[model samples]
Target: RVLVAEPRRIAARAAARRMAWLLGERPGGKVGFTVRGERQAGRGTVVEVVTTGVLLQRLQRDQELAGVDVVVLDECHERHLDADTAAAFLLDVRATLRPDLRLIAASATTDAEGWARLLGDGGTDGGGVEDGRADGTGGGADGSGSERWDGRPGKPAPVVSAPGVSHPVEVVWAPPERPVRPPHGMRVDPALLDHVAAVVRRALREREGDVLCFLPGVGEIARVAGKLGGLDGAEVLQVHGRAPAAVQEAVLSGADGGRRRVVLATSVAESSLTVPGVRIVVDCGLAREPRMDHARGLSALTTVRASRAAARQRAGRAGREAPGVVYRCWPEAEDARLPRFPSPEIAGADLTAFALQTACWGDPDASGLALLDPPPAGAMTAARETLTAIGAVDTAGRATERGTRMARLGLHPRLARALIDGAKEVGARRAAEVVALLSEEPPREYGDDLAAAWRTARHGGDPYATRWRQEARRLEHALTPETSARRGTARGGDGPGRSENGPGRGGDDPEHSSGDPGRRGDGPGRGSDQRGGGGPSRGEDGPGHGGDPRGGGGPARRGDGPRGDNLPTRGSDLRGGNGPARRGDGPGRGGHDPARGGDGPRGG
Candidate 1:
């Protein structure tokens, strides 16, 4: 009945499990979750936790969302591309399709006014004011409470603030004594890692509770974990996206009462799920951002200084249970220069899949949708060209039947095309196996050759290989030949018929068909031997020839000079001249034979 969308699958599962715990039941609890490759909800479930990606997919299939009454977009401040797109479409539904639907966007450090304006007065200019009372108490006549422009409420949506539980968290600035090279690309200076490890050790010795250290990424976590090995009787754990599910679960479970613990984690631990008993926080003051070099077609993660808002969130983790301490790795004065918020993914991410989704949703340009930020024009054009190349869209930028199928596959458009086309090239099983490897890229040790990686994944004992096999089986079932054929036949009428000449002929212009330059005589100007002009002509290959000379299809008479009696020669004066023709002779003129001028032929 109620939907909660999280940015990541792990977070969704964690939220669902936590909600189920609160319900005091298992197996058939009132709260459940549905993510890719997993579903836990039952018929009696009241709250269904799902990833933003899953929510978007569901909306694409059923715009009305059937029985759903309330949709809570959790962690909206993250600003993921799918979340933003989902929010826009949800707003569309709220505006026109389902006015009764209750949409709630939740976040810890969100731009309250921006979101209130977006969802409040229907994204229009409306203002009001509220007292800046933290305890819902009245303010003094001086208006000491939160005041907007001239004490007027900014929008219709009221800003509700829940006072956080009070806990005295001591802030400790532990900047490195010596200068270290700043984070560049995905690399963090090793010196900073060394300092963070020292801080973790110091926290273990002096602090009372377990230590939770935040690093930029997995690599840094591993290095810091290694450096902290000297801590006797302490259990050190690493938590990252690539960490095994059991390990991540163990990290969240906290350490046994007898042992001291140190948990090294990436930004994944910044919010949402709590690490129990973490009273001392070691902040490395760095985070990774997704970067794309569109010119080189390379996408990678880049390290950057953490935002101040993120620092606050990290510090809050330590105070979840009791009074705590936060050791910031950077100088307190430097915090002012940090970015106020992380960049939205839509602004820089490759939008091929987004373009396909919009096209399938019948909004190809995505102009009609109410997105916070419209997809960049150049990126959208590139995405359309990619879709067109893969037969996902027609020349008119409409989604083809194949495109619809691809979108339903729940994969990137490129990977979907590979899976569909690969299945036809090879067997369904082989294609699925290959696509599964691509879906979760093979380990570098698996080698660069995909064929080798496929073989390794089939026979290797690595965890990645195990996951790949499971995914391959799922893909194989989804892409059976019969199913593919049935889908193709069912939607065959929806797609334009393929032309005999080439693909994308549905919207082709008859006057200027995009045919091969060599394939003459198939349409207008086919018989023309000339480069620019068009007519039936048989003459030497030149700019003025109108047709093929060998076939005599040209407009000129046989054995006639370049300027025949019927054809005018370039620059040949009708009054009989050798050089440039006069404008009085005809229209514009250039070099033409004077011998064939005047009344000799129709020269000039």
Candidate 2:
């Protein structure tokens, strides 16, 4: 039996105890625990073990264990990217390495029954157990070892011919029928922090186990924890990709006597790690993701619809150990808009990891295969180009040895590039720090800085400069102080050349201009032409339009000057300056009286 849990859950002393037991030196023999930092089980004994799911996966890749009676995968519901990959690999392992090994998956909240159906019922074939009861063991009437397979009565290891993987879960709706009123607030009705606090208060009053709250990002989690301030007998813990393992452990297992506890977490908790003893779940119905812009090659983590799978996972927290309650902030109708499945990581995320993984797997093109869903062609192309730029893949479409190493490190391609570059200049220690920061949430200062505005004006561009700044800060804070200092020193010493061939472009005179002629202003009047007296005045129509008619019997020509007929004449002078020049005998030419034959009004 293998109990899979989060990395922080496997404490050193607990691990040692488990190891002692596994070695038959202690009471609970056949039990051990392994993690990234420490691995101590009986030197040779192994029956029941507790391990982080990730470590087990790594071991499977590195070590090939033979002769295993059965592989029991507990807590199969996490659905983490690594977990999914591990499960799939285990299926293959069963086919190749251990054909006789029985695979039993246990999950209190996941659809284990559905999996049972998929694996076919282990029930006897047309042989009723009631008739075979005379044998004292509940075996089939045939009575040929149909029971006692695992030392239990009437329950043998059912031979399961994998009937095509379990049917996809369906969306079930239970309408609240509440009137959809325009929620009165400057922002959304469920101010995430407020919702979490409400859940926390209720959990405390009810003396329920620790409360688990799913928020969108690190900022929200912090904000809510801050709001809770200093509550006695209870500790508030924040969980997300950015938090340290120690902090996460403190939340998973609090102080003695089971004092009330609250955990404000990001989507990482939604499907990856399971927090035991959580009796209440508070869901804010939002998850932050990078809003991607293909054209600009940038993205921002904006709030988006959480998938149905994610929602289910959040709700499952309520019923994990026993029957519990879940408080959804939004109306039922709002939940309906969520996607039926978790957003394919390939589609929404930066493709660096996916591309590198595919390259290492020898499928450089990522062409033909049954991926649950494929990323957009443009995204795929961009990732391939990015990988090529980083020298992870050669021109011949093969992953270089360095690429394999990068994939093993599990980081985004851009960050991987930065790490590689940083390593060459700054050294491995600094490079590792940068990679770690890039993987987690950035710091507070980074989030607040105005200088972190988006470079592009597209949908996925850095529209939310505040969020980017926060992420940058989180990234910065995640690293050790020594590493942070080293990065700063390296950056300062690099001179101007360090940024020469940066992500976009850089030089003494940085230009945002794309340098495309189509983008340049090429119309009739622009720039200095307006001040050069080269274009039409403000209200006046140009060239073929606004002009006097009688002056030239047509529209006024350029450079011909203003028409005189339209000019107002002075009242003092009749035929001299400032007056209308007389034509023939008329003193006032424009007012000439034709009835007097031009002589009366003219008065010569």
Candidate 3:
């Protein structure tokens, strides 16, 4: 029996809600749904839930059959990595292991023709021949109608069905234009700023609905929102991941009585859920992502152009209710350069979780797992090494019992270490403080000086910083003598019974050499601060192979009086060679050859 459900009958929101409810029920011990507040199940037969893009991530970890009957991929044309990966992974699984399973890829303005091809559609089923079929019909291959549905004049094909029909979209051409570019080498383009501001002002003037300006990151959003100042008769709201939930709700809800609203947001607004009544979209065409540089042992952030797919989805935000306008901050020519799909987080993110989960799953060679885009070998190796260094993974590359417990915390391994250390020394107070800070933005008001940074953080009233300090206090209050107070409570106390509690009470400053200015410190050793004429207290800590004078050291010098014996000589001058008309054959001409072992030349 084929089911025909109206698009509005079961919308994405309704479906998500339904799934969330279903997952809330406990099944067997095989499936589960976990959210921030609570985890509904440990193991179950079927699970469904809403998380901030963590579902697709979880699925990526388990590539085999997950016993799912159907995957309703809603809003896929959003071009989110999570949605794209879910669709691709489902297709792969259907083609490989679970051919009986079904995939309902839903999108308001998806590339239907292209997707039909991916679904093995043929020409005979009202789908184009490019749909991986012959004559638009199921070529009578592996026994199912495979293509014909909704009666499009073929062999009664039951392989596919068309939910509804749509009229062709007509394009209205505007004059060609380009956004001004920044000077070479600078990443932030001023032209982008002007373009964004212009679009926003236009939206406020003409559009009655809320305006959403998609910026690259929180920093750019903040800067632009500040420039906009609060718009008259409009609630100017800035939204980002780190903002408080109440602030997010206010921004997302907009002003009273359907008033004009402007939400300055990041890429987090790109998908998953829709903010009501947004009809004007201002796109900056830039997004920030972390890309790994394995050689550097760090992940660097880069801002790059958004994909055409992403741009289209953003534009679709305008047409959700009625036809609206989308302003692109970049020249149309740059659209071609955008990536077709966003990069996977797994490819570039810190892989502490990858290491932990793979260990739990009994896969030692996680790099060898059949990933769509595998992580770099160096990154995987680095993750393993980090795990071992933290004792999460043993010499054999297996997760210890402690590692398992730490994984339950859902924190990065390093943060977990800090938490454990903090708990053991200062009670739970300091550990929670450090954990919260590590999870959110670091202490922002602090300058380059570490001591000053700590001091400023201690006094700053920003919610993020305050929450961290509060957690630190909680950890401190949670301390037990057997676990914490018994430990040393002073700095430079790294030996037995050393306490981990309180900053500046842990160990010696590694950069100092035991308060001895003359003693060389670690690495390229510091110069000794000694009194003048203190028996060469500060020696040049240069390379053992000697060094060039062009460096920091002083040049070699010679004494004024080199010859011990003196004799009266004619045509000799002390000041300049011009006055010194000395001759080689004259008296005192047979001088010692200083270059030849200090021996004077033989007197002829």
Candidate 4:
């Protein structure tokens, strides 16, 4: 069996389709693909195409990869976190477990020598090690390598290069005349959009083949597509991560019946699958990079200058079929200032999922792995805290039984916790539906209220709704009791009420409500004590005996009052207010803090 891993689902499906065509069979015949929430493999399948995330999950389950013969890591140049981690772990397996397993990492414009070194080719230095042992003298178990296995460190694996067909691509500098606002917060300046649209019109009028324009993201793609107006005789289609599958298919299928096409797409079209009949390329000179504000706990996509490597990849799209022209929106001098390569996702992304995977892999701190880039220390600490809060890991930083279950669910650790806890509160089906919505946020058109969006997607007819339904079913299946039993582990019994007994549960007294017998609830000079169930003991000279007077000192702590159940419940609405505000209240009355109780000036 052969495994082909792609970065995105669309690319995996495209590769599977091309392989099936080459094999002279239908889509699910000898070649197949398996992406999240979808699978298209059959009994006779020999080559399986899958996303990098899917491949990582497979590695976690079966370290030995019992039956697979070869694994191909495609698009390694992208340097996605999953691909990088998968490559590192595969190297570990090849070195210690399966020397006979063949591993291949393929890319178009990657750091060949760096990857060659990474793949055990000692590079030009001849300093690679074979078995990672002190002596470094072990050979392959299967005797496939007389010296050591392919990619053993210090042992250089042969580099195989295949040259591509020659095609001249003319570079046309089309920088805007005036300085425009740089891309910020997903907004490309209108000035840049106008210039790009004009260039597209010029390309259509002067050039012959279809025009492929690159934008930073979906929002920009939509804006530019709208700016293009009516393309006299050409079809204006947009392709992005969230575009409908049919629209993406149309873009990839090419224009039919001699209709000239202008395909406005995001970085998704930079590489991977080729766009047929594309002879003109319009580069926007901007791309989106994943950024995390660790201090503020906010993660969002930030607009950034397109890297030189990405520009090269985008320009090559135009020349895939024939000689073409690339229209760059930035000046040639600016290219030198752009980053040479895109930042790896591990450097800035939230590492909660990666941390959990590492903990489950027996490397809690991820220090033992042979990763290209070690995870950041601060991010890993935050990840472990989140796992602990979710009851996925114990105080010792070991994966609990629940942690393994959460990891297998294929959702982020936080979302998995929400689903598991929500199921206990609500039904499993309802929890799954809500979790699915959280997994892939519903479109903005579906509205802001989560419940409303859930209802709309539950009954809506759009492609997103269809995908939501499929994901909901998968989540439901993953959370079933039978599945847990089959996995030979019981669900964790830790709940809010049982697991949160700590010193901070009370104020002032460390022994309060902690089941300590040394401290007495009622003491001399203390006002009427409720715990001892006695009334106030007043002096004889004091006022005439009155009914039981309540003690007044300060707010009662947990285990202090008669009830002894003052622990704050989890997910409680702790906002200060006179009472729950009514709907349609003004800003001051709508959950905003006012100067006083009633309507008054709002305070920060």
Candidate 5:
């Protein structure tokens, strides 16, 4: 059996489907896939595609990978932390227990030499890890070993370079005529997208089999798709992580009977799956990445220029099947200024989850692991501190019992904390729903209220709601009934103050509504540190997008809008999910579950 690990769930399914088609059978036959809560494999399945996270979980359960003969890490150049960790773990397995296991780091363009060195030739069975460096022809990171390269012990592995594309690709520079503002904090200049739409039209008019337009996010894809309407019966579809399953199938299946298709996609399409019939590529030259927002206590998605390697990958899509043309949406000279490769996720994303993973793996500080780049010192420190506060790790930087449970859930540490604690505050079902919503986030069409969004997902039959149901069910099943210390505490009162009694002990002497002893300087049962961070003036400790409210992320840290729910709860007007922000929707009203939007009660 061969196991192919893709970076995202969508890619896994698409890859499986593509393979199944080639085998003259449907999925569940020789080629199948298994993602987080979904699976489509049968006893006869020989090739199974899964997300990197799923492969990591399998390794945790059984390091031997028992029945599998080979493991392939597809799209190795993406540089996701999970993929890197998995590669390291796989190398370790190959050197020790699974000597017979074959590892392959597959990519259209990669530093065969660098990867060849990192993945020593243990034999033909030794799987090669990607060096993540770009080959000069374009398809990898810097290929510069100078940038914190993995110095792990391994002899050079054999190189297996695939030949270049058989088709020729013409490149056309299509920069907007007028100067446009650069992208910032999830906001892309409208002018740029408009220009991209124009470029797509030009491609369809002058050349083309099918047009594959690359955009940054789902929102951008939707906007570009919206503009390509009335294209004389040409189908406009979207391809992203959030895109519906049927849509993915159609995109991969190509336009039936040669009907035209304008498939607008995200970076996932860079190397994941080939959208059949695509010969014209429209490159927007923008990508979105997550960065920690220190002021907001949240991780914000920022829009930036696509890396040069990524632009090359996008261009390659056009020339996959035949000679094609790529419309570069920026000036040819400007391409020189673009970054060589995307910033490794380890460098910018919130490291709390990665830290917890390392802790659970028994290498809390990650000193023992072999990685391409070490975790940033400050980020590691912050992540460990957050984990300690959440009781997921001990002072010695080891995983606690609670931490082990959190790791098993495959959720962010903060969200897992919320799921466990909120299960006690609210019931298991409600808590799971809310946590799932917080984790995956409801669609923009799901309305502005978080609680209302849950109800919409519960009652609606749309693709987003279906996925929400699957995730919610998974969380609901994973919930542990163990009664913890944080259970039943007043919401937003998870500050530092020991209390075995009701409402916790802190601040000025006061009394809980239960007549038990409590503290003041806060709402009843609240703490002196109003924002709920364990620190003196910290503002975090939450499961909300407002992460580590001053300490560890949970809820009610920042963006605690008028409802004090921290999450954007729908009411008179909740903008950008910053919670309620209008008259009659201000905080402090009893009998209302600010988030639930029902009579359940107010809290996370």
Candidate 6:
């Protein structure tokens, strides 16, 4: 069996289909694909294409990749963190467990030598050189110069040279007439999108084939696509990670006969999938890279100049079928000034998920994995710290059972935690839907309201909605039996905010929990014929003391001031507040506990 790792989901599916077509069969027949929430493969499949993240999961589950004879990491130059990690894992497998496994890293642009060295020496560079092929067969005479594979484990993997058929891509300087400000975190100058849109229009007028314009992010793609509006004789589509699956398919499928297309895409198209009729490329010369704001303890995508290699790859999209031209939105001088290659995601991106994967794979700190570049120490530490807080990993950075479950859900730890708790509070279906939204953010058109966005998904027939439903279902199914059962139990009446006393019925501390901040007796003693926590006072309004409105029954006292005393709360906020919730608020009655479908919180 052959497993091909692609950086993006679209690429995985498209590559599978293309390979299956070339084999004169439908996908899942001889070639199949598996992405995060979907799979189109059968046991009869011989070649399977999957995204790097999927491959990582497979590796964590089965380190040996049993029965898999060949593994191909495509588009290695892209430097996606998952791909790099998968590559490192495969190298480890070959060196230790599956010595017979054949590995191939297919990339056209980056330093082939560097990859060969990394692949050969298990991360260390110094090694004997080899010009021969590994085990597996390849073309020696097709004239395309593409390397044929041979399986073998050697000091540094063999470097097979490929000089496939090519056409010249003419570069044109099409800088904006007016100076535009450089990009900042997620902010691209609107003027640049305007310039890019104009360039697309100009390319359509002057160039012949379909135009593929590279934008920095999803927002930029959307803006340029809007500027293109609805073009006559051409279909304008947006392509990126968040693009509606249908829209992405349309881009991959190409336009109708005699119809042109202007595909505004992110860098995913750089080497992932080749748009069908692309002959004119509009290079926006911008890209978004992940950056960890250490001070703020958050990760953000900062827009910057696209690396020269990325620009070349984007420009090469135009010349895939015939001679084409690339309209550089920046002057040629700037091209020379750009970095030679895009930074690897591991360097700056949040490493929590990656760290979790490493922990699951037995490399708690990932120090042993063979990588093109090591993940930053500070980033790894931060990630481990987060894992510890979420209880996803132990103090030793080892994945806990919960962490393993979270990893299998294919979500970030935070979202995974939300899903688990949400299922108990809400239901499996509801938790799945919301988590799916957070996982692959809704399209811009979905609006800023999450609830509204969810409703749109529930009723709309748009591709985003379609994909969301599919993902939501997948997530629901992924929920553990324990979690699903817990949700069912909650719905059956024994869940959060449901104690038979009042809204916040729970084990109570004495004296208004002594956490209330009102003047001495003003807090109204706890046992004073009144409760002031999750529920209302049994008697009157009671004291001026509500313990903590901040929920969490965490460290604060019931109806206490903000952040409260250091003493722990009696129990979780599950039962309304610091005391037993009233039967009305309980699951069986007309209580207004928001946990279920109830309207809101109610008094004791």
Among these predictions, the greatest lDDT belongs to 5
By TM-score, rank the candidates, best first: 5, 4, 6, 1, 3, 2
CA displacement after TM-score superposition, residue 133 of candidate 5 (Å) = 13
TM-score of each: 0.74, 0.52, 0.56, 0.76, 0.77, 0.75
lDDT of 5: 0.59
Off by over 4 Å in 3: 1-34, 38-48, 52-187, 442-604
Scored against the true structure, residue 423 in model 4 reaches a CA lDDT of 64
TM-score for candidate 2, please give it. Answer: 0.52
Q: What C-alpha lDDT, on a 0 to 100 scale, does residue 517 get in candidate 6?
A: 15
| Alpha-carbon lDDT of model 2 | 0.38
Please tell me which predicted candidate would have the highest TM-score against the true structure.
5
Model 6: residues >4 Å from true position, as ranges?
A: 122-154, 230-232, 444-447, 481-604
Q: After superposition, how far is residue 145 of candidate 5 from its true place, in Å?
A: 13
Q: What pairs collide in candidate 4?
A: 121-156, 128-153, 128-154, 129-153, 129-154
Greater-TM-score candidate between 4 and 5: 5
* lDDT of candidate 4 over 1-604, digit per residue (tens): 8888776666777889988988888777789877665678877888988776667677777898888888888767666656777787777777678877777767666654455556653232322222211122222222123232332435444445544653778999999999998866334577887888899999999899999998764445556778888778998987654456788788888889898999987666776778888999999887655445565333334556877877877888888889999999998889899987777767875566677777777778877676656789988897787677667888878899898877767655655665665566446777677655544434446653344466688899996688677767767777985764453211221111000000001000001101011111110111111111000111211221111121111222333211123222233111112233222211111111000111110110
Model-by-model lDDT, in order? 0.57, 0.38, 0.40, 0.57, 0.59, 0.58
Q: Poorest 10 consecutive residues of model 2 by lDDT?
A: 504-513
The digit string of per-residue lDDT tens for model 3 on 461-553 reads 764455446435533432343433232121111111000110000010001101111111011101111111100011212211112221111
lDDT of 5 at 205: 89
Give the total clashing residue pairs for model 5. Answer: 19
Candidate 5 local Cα displacement, residue 394, angstroms: 0.6
- Cα RMSD of predicted structure 4: 17.4
Model 2, residue 224: C-alpha shift (Å): 1.3
TM-score of decoy 1: 0.74
Local error of candidate 1 at 439, Å? 2.4
Cα displacement (angstroms), candidate 5, residue 385, comes to 0.8
